[model samples]
Target: MSACSVFDRIFMAGLVEMNLSFASKYGAKALGR
Candidate 1:
């Protein structure tokens, strides 16, 4: 793979991970169970 594509994928993956982690944290807090 090219360097540019590799970087793009890594960046996208990081963003996805951050989003999922944020959502999961809030969901858990909302339950309060």
Candidate 2:
């Protein structure tokens, strides 16, 4: 695979991880309320 494609995959993975963490935090706050 090309370096550019590999970098793009890593970037997408990072975004997905960030979104998952953000969602979990929001869910926890909602539950607390």
Candidate 3:
């Protein structure tokens, strides 16, 4: 695999993790206390 592809995957994973954390934080409030 190329280094660019590896970096892209890591970047994407980081974004996904951030999004999941964001969603969990706000979604919990939107859904309920």
Evaluated at residue 25, the lDDT of candidate 3 is: 96
Candidate 1, 1-33: lDDT as tens digits:
899999999999999999999999998999984
- Model 3, residue 20: distance off in Å is 0.4
TM-scores of the candidates in the order shown: 0.72, 0.83, 0.83
lDDT of 2: 0.97
1-33: candidate 3 lDDT, tens digit per residue: 999999999999999999999999999999997
Model 2 agreement with the true structure over 1-33: per-residue lDDT tens digits: 899999999999999999999999999999995
lDDT of 3 at 15: 100
Query: Each candidate's lDDT (Cα)?
Result: 0.95, 0.97, 0.98
- The residue pairs that clash in candidate 1, if any, are none
